[model samples]
Target: MSMPRSIGSGPAPRHGSIARSSFSASYLSQSPIAQESIARDLAEYSDDEIEQPESDSEESGSEDESDASTVRPNAPQHSMASSYRRPSFVAFGGTRPAITPHGAEGTFLTKKEKKQARDEERSLLRDNHLAPPKHPEPSRRNTLSRIYKKVFSTKTPKTESDLEDPPEALFSAEPSESSTLLSNGPPESKRSRREREDREWEAAVASGKIKTTWQREAKTLMTNASPLVITFVLQYSLTVASIFTVGHLGTLELGAVSLASMTANISGYAIYQGLATSLDTLCAQAYGSGRKHLVGLQFQRMVYFLWALTIPIGIFWLLAEKILELIVPERESARLAGLYLRILLLGAPGYSAFEAGKRFMQAQGLFSSCTYVLLIAAPLNAFMNWLFVWQFKWGFVGAPIAVAITDTLLPILLFLYVRFVDGRQCWNGFTKKAFRNWGPMIRLALPGLLMVEAEFLAFEILTLASSYISTTHLAAQSVLGTVTALTFQIPFPISIAASTRVANLIGATLSGAAKTSAKVAFIVACGVGLFNVALLFFLRSYIPRLFTTDPEVIRLVSTVLPICAAFQLFDALAANCNGLLRGLGYQEFGGWVNLFCYYVVAMPISLGTAFGLGWQLEGLWTGPAIALGLVAAAEGWFLTTANWEKAVEDARERNSNG
Candidate 1:
């Protein structure tokens, strides 16, 4: 073995000039007298003479020598810091030497020992590294960082060498590993290893080894979607509470209430909800373009148009008893349903106003507000229903009355919040500008209304067809419909989210991003639909027991529930694709698609199979499932082939005109 340079004796190597493993502390500590003699002799040399290390041929020869030799003129003195450890050197042209930071002593440490040392050092330096402490104790920022590290930290320990240089310096000053590997002559002529690390990082992102944009979008969507989904679910639960309360009254009461609620949903609520959705396209684009006032104007117009339609709709509800009697010979049930309809009509204007408010709030990205309000109102609705029906003894009349009170309160509360609390900038107190030329607004509103109502009316026709089988069949069908409605709530938010997001992107003229949003929405909706299908299939036999205990009703529900489960994927696809079309100003296309699929295709097949062919209830649902499948296919094709650039142009024009 060659003798190492005597410590504090001969002239030393400069900082980072020599390899870490080149010297031994134990060997130098052996002869203090000899080190002193060499140190006194080396004091004559200048820093420049001892700055650069010799090549490996010279270094290897020095290691082999048994006796001390004359120090090279180019060797630099190591006077930087006694405690500092230099970074490990890269093997530019040959195999890397073993790293030993404390001369030869550093090689003795196991991986665990090295890790423990690093951790201890990190803890000691943590509070002093960033901003200086204000007091003797750790600052809140430092304390929070410690807590965060404890919660989210990985097991790996980082060495001081890794933290010594800033990333920008390392990346900019060095060359890639590939260049060094390929160089057959002098490796130092090419780039350094640090640059290679930067290149690898960029490549990793490009290859998806480390996700960037898509991951960011996924997290953004999840954060925005969770509350919206919860809001839809909680709102739907109010309907469930009403059904549960009224279903216990008796079979006739249950059937009557179910028929009444379904009629209101199909005829009144469905049509109005559809009409109000035109605001989703207009308001979302408006908000995206920073035209906040336009969102309020669109909302006002929707309220105006919807409230006007309700007057004509209220006349239809007045004749609902006769309409019900014509469809089914159950005169007693029809009379009861008409009575329920008349009471519910009191809340129609409130419902219209609330729908408009929700779209307005949703457009401006105030997603959590809707959920917060619904959370309070949903429970209140349930309590009020219990109070009026059971405590006040108003019978079936109480359910609609309770619903009307809450329905009216919902819009009032939303308006108060928007007008005074958070949405003041958008509202501007409802303008008369909303009452201008109604031609364009009417044209946009009609298509969306027709699209949703066509599908809803088709299902109602199936319910009417169920009446042809028997009233018991109708009652059983109602139970099945409730279960399906509950499952439908799962994907409904994805639809709303898709439309709002796409419209915003379109308004911003981000066609690529808008297309990506559509694709992601479809994927998320489909996944949620499939998950619900699995859950429904798992609980199909048992869920009917929650609604009714009658063997016939339970048996009928158990039979049809699986079909409902099968229909969910297609239903989700159809709904989300319709939302995409609405965002693209293609609601008219969706309306025509719905008209053909539901009325022309689904209705005929449903009626013929149930009544003409005598296939009963099973045949009734087969039509809708098949029709939804066709609708999904058609809409998916349209969305995939859509010209997103044109969508942006159309959105701008619509918002400007509105």
Candidate 2:
């Protein structure tokens, strides 16, 4: 191993030359150190260099070795500090290195010692990776890590090596373990991104600023994927079927039902989503903190909380007409929406329950069952809606009632299924104790509720405003909104699947897998979006006549159908992006992104162009096309932008404090 050096004298061989983030090649190209950069960069970022100095571990030294490697012709002495034991992949269940950190056989830790060493490494890795150790393999190592972590939780410095580098001196940094994790090269784009992350880690650790652990990197298995899949299946199956069945009524009625339902759903979803998101924070964080049992209690409490809130929700449903009137008092188109809301209230509790059920499964990482349950509930919801609205000729009023029946019964059925058909470890025991302990549960869900509240208030205002444009425009808005709803359903699976997988991986601290899951979700969502757009385009005109018989309404919607078809792909992107953000505990990002997209960009573009420019309903779509497209792109980028190692680090710091 090479010795430590001062910050600016020259790049050391062991730690390498620090490239200032502010260093421009324009200036650095003229410098003496610039000529020696290859050696510095190689030493700094050697992908094969997994070894740390032996003397640095057991024997203390002022300057571990001679700081005279390549880079410095003068070999000016500069110092750096390198403490916290670097973790190896073996700690995370990858192949164990036959040789130790020093590359010696004699001083190498014994099997127990090796396990202990790896355990500490795993803790650090998992702390950044976001997964818990699974099975008989690393349990012993993890336990020792736990004990060691408890006692020596803080970084301990035995040797002073390349630690005091300037923050910017890492720009020239290169590949990370992730680069090697790929046998073949990743795309240039990905390899560059990975290098940036490694430099970030280097800068953070070198600067003594704690690196953030990635949330999804903790456990990418099935955590996020499960929740999203479950939510998507349930919401999409029921929603699409309802739209189709109602659309068959004719354009006017079709649009009205679709419009009102869309409005109602966003509103209701805002509420449930707000509450459920809090459950995610609570459950994931709690699970991270080793409070697994508390998650069950929180799930139960969320149920009651959602139920208690339902009374007011029901009252609001009762005043659906008044609400609609107040929302769009002058618009005749709003009349149908008002009627629909009054009827839809009967199912508020059911809506709340279904959401709670998801949180329950999500808490325990048993999110796979949600898709199964959705399959059951979605079909039932459609059948009931079809039977009452079309077969029975009840009109838009029947649409709401049928939906209520479906929502109300869904929770009860899901609960039975959870208990009987496919049992869970967390849900296996039903107890009074669980009911009595609601403290943590309430804490977990509160943040999510707050977020939902902010989002709902914003959309509610927009929905109300859209009703005034024109009867035709309103109907158009209805159809387009339903299309948006239907298309959005695709990403829920991707998001939930990510949440469950990422959360478990985070808990287990398996980073590489967590990152891969994020990739899987993004790819899957895009593929689904592509498919949805094709199907929607194919079924456009034929689909609209189901709700209303008005040829004009149908004609208007058909003209716009192609636009929706083009936009559906963006819709998928936005939904999936939001899902990915939620999995990463980045709801705040969603809140801000939505605020900008809906209010600043989307609202202005859609409403302004439609109402002000006389494009009316088409204007609404135009705005969404631009705004939603931007949002989808942003979200997709964010999902792909995740640095799982950082996520693991952040989770560990957060968990340790908690």
Candidate 3:
């Protein structure tokens, strides 16, 4: 005759929710293991120090002390003769074991009694007649110190010296008998989302440079300069072929080729470079962190993923004439530009894929592949241009066909090389994990894409704006633009190398090295820009002859060459700033910088100066010069002022849980 457990005042249903049944059975044994353990621990404590068990439970959850005290538990000894009754700590009737409880004064609180005491304490606090207690609030300084000790105490590896001793040793390769992964996670995956976050946070906490430098800034500048040199060579080659072949066909064919080449390279530069370079950032970081598998997976996914993005680009290629008609108002120029753009576009996706694959290799410190790939394709592109235009008598259309074939071929060749050569050689480094996760790809690409679009739009608008000027002015603008494009490659490669190094040093938490690298890159770019300025001034006459020999066009172009010469310093600053920002995952900031430079300040002032100030075409180009120069100086100084240690500390704080 034990009293049954109560379920409210109503009769209980035979069948109910599964949870209700479990609850009914669980209430029978209220002395859970946690409660028992607490009781056992309290056995060693003095009677006055032992806390009430119910109060401990309530405090754990923090909101139910009153409810806990209302429990009408059936006593263990009084069970033989019991009746359902209102709860009272002191019993009135029944069992002899309940007659005299002698040791009760020892003060070991039962769960129910402790809960009652807690409820009384709270009630007293709420009582209107009782005065409020005066207590000082917890200071953040003390709390933070405790937290710091907890995080960075004996277990925290603070210095290179601290890491010498191993902490709570982990199995070298997991337990052999029942081996858990000796690796971090899935065999294909090198680093989990959580793992990367944790390590980055830890590195940041150490106040280490995520990007560092020393003598390498000069190297970074040299690296950036190579492409500029190459660009100049390519422009020379293009001009030689166009004049040699299409020059005999009259101004229409010559102009057509001009429109086509301009459209093709401009599109290729942005679309292909944007996607491919973003991959380089990812691959570089992965390489730095020793995530061998991610490099390959990233490469593979990019190949397939690029195919998707290429569809729209491909469509533009296919419909180049239609697009030209819409964008270009002069009917003849529009038709000619459209025809050339369409042919060039046929080879868009292939060229784009080539760019992406090459960037992956570049990130691995394999820039030679780019040179090798260029060796096979660039000369072939030139030869094909001559053959199709002069050798086959296809005219302007032949140049586009030639570009298309070569553009597609380069990517195919690179993809094959990566698959057969790098594929088997570095299986571990080419993990399939990156292909599986879309997160990294998206994070890297979005910002770069924004930059590419903004930059491309700015130039396209310039072209449109230039069209508003006289024909001679338009020609000068184009000549200056083309020269700048060709020569700017000098600093680009250095920027590329700096980007990879910054990412690597940043990841390693080598703050000093990262700073050195940025400075080195800046100094190198400045030197290269200075040399380029002097060289352009000395060879001003020969430079215009490279594109065309039309006396008037050449004269206007020569006049503007000096203006182009003046912007190299600005180019160095802006390009390297872009590198620094991209390396430090400040892509969004770069985008904002571009927005301000291109639209907010530069475009309006330059446009106003060109048209409003009666400066005309030369004045329009001057707009971006001033804007880019100012932005470069500001961004470079900002990079200088940044607290690398604090940045790392913030990153580490975010990643502690992992």
Candidate 4:
């Protein structure tokens, strides 16, 4: 054994003298895995063992030699004592040790013996130890080979316990099949990787090895929702554009159009939208369960049911003048609002039919045609409003007429698309079975309608209450409401997408996926809400100027807009959760939640804070904010923790019974 001079300054150990060896820092630094292994081995050898070199024991060495002689009886010269000596740690400048045969000592060796001794010492040093070999180590280069093997080799994990992947990476682009995939196999494209991940995910879920990641679920929801959101913005702009066009007519026309729009929203539009959601559940489940054609029939049934319900609604609109006279202060404005209402009433059936068609298309994942149809209808609606109201000089009546024509055109467009181009597999040309399912349609629709109606009526009540305070406050509230409505379009599409996706997954008996969809929907809605808050916070002072430059109205709007901005998060979450309920077929429960949160909790707070506490418009806005918070909290908790297995069963039953 040999040691370096003072580890740096002293002479090397004389040959045949005991010495210790330490690895070079440069060698250890070259390979982290080697360094780690060496460090671990060093730790295993305690301080007392490494620091204290044992003295030569003649008794033990003699006994080992005697045992070796007994084993090799004919060769008593084969002494184990020779093998008991510590190896040398010679640097490049130091003399190498001589290899001696058994019982040979105090003598120099031949060239072959010295070479063998040097090789043995090198092997021991490569292992960072000076002890003699226990059995035998392979060549020193083998250690380096192992390190390189670890560095470059890609091996599939043998067991679930061996897998250290994060949830995000569970669906990552890695090839887990084999290490030889790159060399001995075909090249894997991105699409193939994604498909492999999909198969793996389904297997994992089935075996309960892993649940779907919320991030992956959100990505799925966003992938499905993005185009739908664009479509919604385009479709909703039809109404906004109508308002913009009519605003150029006169202040009276502006107020009349605003009132008529709000009335139509609460009375007819919201109900129709809610009722159409029934198809979201039925169609999505049917499509997912592989009964694709049933979705089309369900869409037809929804349209028929909604159109029949619109008859009495039209009669109610015919008496809109008298109804407006009771609530509205000005008789002339009331008379004009009535006329606007009657014209808008002609679009009610069309609106309902469009909603049904939209949900049907969305359920089957045929979003492109719906978007293309709305893409044309939205701009056409705007053009007609411009032509009929401004160019034609038809004034207030022309706005409603243009809106009616646009609304009527949507269903015809969607119907033509389904009949001639898309959804032919599901359409089957309308069936008698659809007419017979009136009872089931009503059962499913009423709860959804009530759920939407409760929330809609709550806002409408606030609008009506604002009118009592002052017409100026009413107008300011309307401007703020419009801004909120536009921002709301962001989450509205997310809810619809989430609902459809969840229902689809549930129908396929993928309960875990359904739950993931709900979770992702809630999370994305919150993110969008935060964005809305930031956007509106920056624009609060300037947004009012878009609708009007009147300082008084602007000042009032500026005061209330911040409060509205603050509620955007809760509003987004609550709205998306409601969508979750619709997809889970818990529309009845959602109706109760809205009824309690808005009517019982929010309405009183609003009326009391505004009139009793004299906070006025801000107070009125504050109540809805509080209600939205409560609803978001309640619904978020339920959706996050609800029994997704039961949701799947319920979806199956709903589709089965229908």
lDDT of each: 0.55, 0.46, 0.47, 0.56
lDDT, candidate 3, 1-658, per-residue tens: 0000011110010000000000000012121222332233334346764333233232344222222222222121111001111110110000001000000001012233334333322222222112122232246558788886555432212345323522112112122334344465444222232232233333332432122124334444454445534532442343344444553444345444544544553454444444444453454333323333444555666766777777776676667777766765556766876777777667767755665565456444344454555556656767887789878879777866876787678777766676766533223343334345554465555544544444445554565566566444544555565556545545544554565455434433445656777777777778878887887777778776765556766786677777777877777667667656655545346556656776787678868987899777677778777877877877777787877765444323322211
Q: What is the lDDT of residue 210 in candidate 3?
A: 24
The residue-level lDDT of candidate 2 at 159 comes to 26
Q: What is the C-alpha lDDT profile of model 2 across 370-465, one tens digit per residue?
A: 556556766777788778877788866776787778777767776777778753444424445434444444554454455434433443444445
Q: TM-score of every model?
A: 0.60, 0.57, 0.57, 0.61
Error of 4 at 276 (Å): 4.3
Q: Is candidate 1 or candidate 4 better by lDDT?
A: 4
Scored against the true structure, residue 162 in model 2 reaches a CA lDDT of: 23
| RMSD (Å) per prediction | 28.1, 20.8, 27.9, 31.2
Report the number of the highest-TM-score candidate. 4
- Candidate 1 structure quality by residue, lDDT tens digits, 448-485: 45544443455666666776677667777767766676
Better of 1 and 2 by lDDT: 1
Q: Considering TM-score, which of the candidate structures 2 and 4 is the better prediction for this target? A: 4
State the weakest 10-residue window (summed lDDT) of model 4. Answer: 1-10
lDDT measured at residue 364 in model 1 versus the true structure, 0 to 100: 49
